[model samples]
Target: MPQTLKTLGPKAAADLDGDLMSDAGGFSIDQLMELAGLSVSQAVYNVHPPSAGNNGGDGLVAARHLYFYGYTPVVYYPKPTKKPIYDGLVKQLNNLHIRFDNETPFDKLAGESDLIVDALFGFSFQPPVREPFDQAIAVMEKGVKPVLAVDTPSSWHVEDGPQNEGLGSKYMPDYLISLTAAKPNVGHFKGKKHFIGGRFLGEDVAKKYNLNIPEYKGLDQIVEVPVDVKVEKL
Candidate 1:
C-alpha cells in the first residue's frame, strides 16, 4: 500500500521561516542549502542517473556541484548576463569542474541532455517568465526526456499551477524536489514523484509554524511526498 501523505496550504507553508534562526540541530540556511543540494543529487541518482548529460538552471547547477563533487561532468545553460550571482555560480562551477554552455541555443542543449533539471526559478517566481528563461523553458518543454524541478516548476506560480496559459501544460515536470517544506503550488503537482528535502527544522520551530512535516526515517535527508494525497491544515 502507498504511504499516507500530508499536505499543507500556502498560508501554513509560508510560515516555515524557521530557518531564520539556529534550530535544535543548529543548522543555518547555508548548512541547509548544502544538505538540500546533496539530497537533490541523491534523488536524481536514485531515479534517473545522468546518461547523456544533466541540464539545469542555477539551483540545479548548485546541486550538481555538490552532486558530482568535482567528479561527473554536467551541462549548464545560463542566461547572457554579468550579474554577480551568476558570476559567483560560474566560479563555483569552475571549482567543481562542471561545464556550461551559455552561447549554444536552448533547443540544441535540450536535444543532447538526457535529463532536465528545472532550477531556472523557484516558488518565488511569478509568471510570464522573462526573456531567456522563457525561451529556455520552451526548449525544455519540447524535449522528450524527463524533467526534475527544484522547489516548484519554473514559470509556475507558487499559488497556481501553469494556469498562466502562455507557458502551457508542457511546462510540467516529471519529478520535483521541494526545499524545506512543500509550497502551495505542490498541491497541484502532477508529477510521478515528489520529494521533500532540507529537513533541518527543530521540533519547536515546526510546531510554532504548524509545519506538521513528516519525520525522515533513519538517516535519510529526503522523503517522498505522494501527490493527490489527503489535505490537512498545519
Candidate 2:
C-alpha cells in the first residue's frame, strides 16, 4: 500500500479508495523505477566493468552520454513529491560520472552521444506516448548509436510479448536490462539479442558497487561478462 493510504484508517481509506488503490496488480510505480534504475546500473557495470584497481575487476570506467527519457528528469522533477526520487537517482549517475540529458533536441543529442540509456516508458505504459515522450522518441530516432533501455524500450508492448514492431518509435535497445525479473517482451525486441540481466547484486558486488541499502542490496548477480564489459562490435 502507498504511504498515503497506510496513514488512513479503514473507513477513511475506503472513502478515498478507487484511484488510491486502483487494481494495477502488485508492484508500485516507485518500486518499478528503482528496479529499472538499479537494473540498468548493474548492466552498465557488467557491460563496462571498472578497472582492476577501481571496483570489481571493472576497468577504468569511462563517462558516456546516458539519456533518461521517462516522465521524471534525472536531477529534478517539477512535482514536489517526485523531487527526491529523481534527485537521488541523478546523484547516483553523477557519482558514476555519467553525462545525461533529458528531452533535449534530437540532432544535438545524436551528435553528442556515444551511448544512450532509455529510461522512458516501461511495463506501465499503455499506448502512444503523449507530447514530451514523443518528442524524446524523435530525438532518439535521429541517431543509431548503441542503446541500453532501462526496462523495455519505449513503446514496446509488454502485453504483446517481445516482438519487434519496427515502427518509428518502436525502439529495440542493444541491451534490455530487466528489473527484478525478466519480462516476455524482450524476446521479441528487435535489436541484437537482448542481454538479460538484473540488479540482484551479490552482497560482495553490492559493496563493490557502493550500494548499501539492506533491502536494495544482495540481489542475485545474473551475468558473467568481464568487469570491463565494453567492446567494439563487428
Candidate 3:
C-alpha cells in the first residue's frame, strides 16, 4: 500500500515527531530514539549487518543495536552532544566498548566502512552544514561506499533535497531510512533503497495527521518502501 503512506513536510514531520516524544504521545525521547535507531539498524541489516553510525542519539541507538545484532560498529562522531540522554547513549556504547573515532579522517572511515550511516543530521536540522560536519560531508560526498541516511542526510533540506550549494552536485546516498514517515525530500533521493521507520507512532498523532503508515510485517521494526533503485519520484 505505497499509496497509503503519507509524506510530511519539514514542519509537519517535526511536529509529528515531537508529539510522539512528548507525554501526549506516551513516549519518552530515549524510548522513541531507541526505536528510531532500531528501525534504522533493521534497515541496514537487510543490506549491511551491524551498522548505522551517527553522533545523534539515533546513531548511538543504532550502533548499540547493531552490536547486539552482531556487527562491530565503529562510531565517527566528531561533534558529540552534551545533553544527558545523548551522553548516556555514548556512555552505553563506551561501556559496550564500541569504537569512537573522532581522530580518524572521514576518507579513511569511508574507505574502510562497508556502509556509512548518514546520521549527522535529522529532520530537526536546519543549516549550511557547520564545523567538523561540513568538512566530513565534503569527504563523504565523494565516497565510493554505500550510505544509509537515518532520516535526513547531513546538510540536506528537510523539506527539499540537497539544495544546499555544496551538496547539490555531490553523490547521493545508497539507502535512506526515513524515520516516523518519509519526508518530502524523498522525492529527490537517488538512492537504491528507501524505507519508512520510526514505528512508534500513537493513534493520536497518526489520526491527527491522518497518516497511513504501512504495517511492519511480524516483529519487524522497519519495512522497505519498495522504492528501491531510486526514490527521486517518491
Best by TM-score: 3
Scored by lDDT, the top model is 3
lDDT of each residue in 94-136, candidate 1, tens digit only: 7766767767777776676666767777555766777777777
Candidate 2 overall lDDT versus native:
0.42
Q: Which stretches of candidate 2 lie over 4 Å from their true place?
A: 1-36, 48-83, 90-103, 161-170, 199-220, 224-234
| Reference-based TM-score of each model | 0.80, 0.51, 0.89
Rank order (by lDDT, best first):
3, 1, 2
Can you write out model 3's per-residue Cα lDDT over 178-198, one digit (the tens) per residue?
888777777777778888887
Local error of candidate 2 at residue 115 (angstroms): 0.5
lDDT of 3 at 186: 76
lDDT of 1: 0.65
TM-score-superior candidate, 1 or 2: 1
Backbone collisions counted per model: 0, 16, 0
The TM-score obtained by model 3 is 0.89
lDDT of each: 0.65, 0.42, 0.75
